[model samples]
Target: MKNLMFFFATALLTITLTFAISPPASADVPPPPVNQVLGLFDATIDFTGADIDREFCQQCHVGSQVERHHALVTPTFGCFECHTLTDGTFAEFRECTFCHQTSPHHTTAEAQARHCSACHGSLVADYDDGHYIPSYATSSFTPLTGGVEPDPTNHPGEYAGGCKACHMEDIGQGIASNATTHHGIGITECSWCHDVEAEATLSIRKCEDCHDVNSLHNIQADSDNDGVITPGTETGGYGHIGANADCYGCHVQSFLAFMSTTAAEPTIPSITSLSATVLTAGQAANLTIAGESFMNTSGGETFTPVVEITKGDNVVILYPLPAFTSKELITPVPATLEPGNYELRVKKDAVVSNKMTLTVAADVQVSAANLTEETIVITGSNFGNQPGETTLGNTLGTVQSWSDQKVVVLMPEAVEGQTVTLVTAAGAVDNTEITAAKATAAVKEKIKGRANKGSIKTKSTK
Candidate 1:
């Protein structure tokens, strides 16, 4: 009984000393129930562990922070995936290099600035002056946030923003729940949004997301390096810069002038042969010229096919038939040509075809007319070396022989004073005062005298 009483007295003394050394509690209030205190602490901590839903994080991360996390994080990942928990609290991670070693963001500011051109080349090329960071004269300028208006001077080229200035701003503060931040609207990085096949295509529409119509036209970059600045169609290094608008829209007449100067000149037509190399003067003939690339009338409103014959400094223009083809064209020879050689050419637009030789012979002329017992001899220049029609008065005559300069024909029964006409392939000649009866009598007298002389000579020989 004495030992038990002493143990109780020591326990009582220890309890009294512990209470005396402890700090005083406020207002002597008793501690809350254990369950109530645990419940309050649980509300501040994420006890769901790895299976926790994203809604648990949304409660704390309200506006742009939530939007930025959703945009950059992969779908399969959650808030805890990139962050760490220490003493029941979550710590924020600012450096992407902590988890991603090869990430594009793992570089210095200068390196990041230089690498911007790889993806944003069109934006870099448009402005002649280099990109610059915006400067505010006073510290009173508040960054854009919930329900705040953007400054008018904050345009792209004015006192405007650079890449980080615009992209890093708090864009989701005033935006609707369904809306997205500026960086979330379109893909800034190729690898993040596009697959291999999509990257290979590199369509121009991707560039139109940030660059407006006028901005693309101002680029003036020879992207393909073909020496021609075909904005919308150019490909390769910079992708497609002009997807929303063409270069001509802003350049106007200057674009047209450039195209005119750089375009290929029209091909000149060639003249190989002509139908009638030699034509008679004072007569019209259908002439056919054969060559390549002869312009037809159906080419369009600007098609004007002109056929011309040039002699020395003189040029005679001829109209080509509408039915002409590229291979050949039929035109009429002008009767104004004198007896000389000329060059025939076809001109289409500013191109003149090769020259072909064309000769014009003098008109046929009658030299003489004579008559024999049964035939009439007609002599002329340019008889064409062929049989021709002959007539005395109203009687038709048959041609006995023909030559280029002379023709003989059997004369039918006709009066003494009659007109004789000779018609060759080239032209016709007429003699108004030639008489066949007088020439026939003269021929009969000459033949009789020759026969008498022949008879006298035979008698002397016997």
Candidate 2:
């Protein structure tokens, strides 16, 4: 009876070992639940909607275990993946310090460099300075894509600034104005983003991302008191002026460092042509200069352009004060210019353009001459709006009427082969004349021996 009882016990033990060691009867047989204590896990934490935060993690991990995830792996695993109480939200990144000692996560330079990749490798895969993860204290900033992708074509350098510039509380005033925490990253504390060994010169070259180039904050105030206000100036060209809040509260220091380190290539102004080659002296001339990159807005910036006219031993600078465009500038050339040859050029700040030749010639030209009964009408250009004087070969003619293009003077007591001359404010000159009459001595004798020096006399209105 004892042997039979022992045999049954051995057989029972054998059957138990076989069941435990055997493979599943079929692949369809469902595997065990991922969690051993599935019932307790379900009862403790609701996998559905819940406002989860750092305090909520304590229920399972107890004290520090809540923050014990590998710091390097956290970004990949993502706190929200398991902190599953909230959807699309993670505990403030500052809470990351509870378990990971950021003060000295990696001791060596090589190790620290590698350490930087653990968190930033995935976040900045595309060099997107705008990448951000919302904190439990704040809702996720929407459309998390479309951040500034700095490259050689757009934003030449690594100008993402730092994570705190847009993702930290109090500091992220540009786009992360609603940010409640640091989102787990410190801008200055991270050796990779800033030079913790020295005065923490920023590595990614930020601020211009959201403020100047991005057109979001458009902070173009002259905060540095330099009097020059434009994008890429000494203060990153984004000042606190007119800001709804103190925009410089965080940017003042970082931006100064950025400008000092990076050199922005100025858009040099160019000159293609000038509208007029000759300008009248003693008369204002509207001169239009065509070019590229002529800055006019908020004038007084360093790149403001001015026209420089240089004569043999003198120079005249003209500013297009009232208004101008990037492609053209119409400025009144002062009447003060003397009659002479001059070299004209456009100067943008200190950059000078190619020289163009301009002549300030005597401003007068004779177009035609006609003889009316007892008067000679001289038609030409630049005949001074105000009446001047007219002469006919050693004889003075009585001025009948005078205008810029047509000047009529009573016929002088003259004869054939005589010359007619006009004198105006332009200059004392005989630059214009009428052809001598072909009439014979008999015709000259008919009218007191006077022959019209130009066209045949018209019938007298008298």
Q: Judging by TM-score against the true structure, name the best candidate.
A: 2
lDDT of each: 0.40, 0.40
lDDT of 1 by residue, 241-347 (tens): 22222222222222332232223222334454565555667776666665444542211222435676776667777764433555556666656676555666776
Worst 10 residues of 2 by lDDT: 6-15
Evaluate model 1: give its lDDT.
0.40
Give per-residue lDDT, candidate 2, residue 256.
29
lDDT of 2 by residue, 327-348 (tens): 5556557666765556676655
Model 2 score (lDDT): 0.40
What is the number of backbone collisions in each predicted candidate, taken in the order shown? 0, 6
TM-score of 1: 0.27
Q: Find the candidate with the highest lDDT and give its number.
A: 1
Q: Clashing residue pairs in candidate 1, if any?
A: none
TM-score of each: 0.27, 0.29
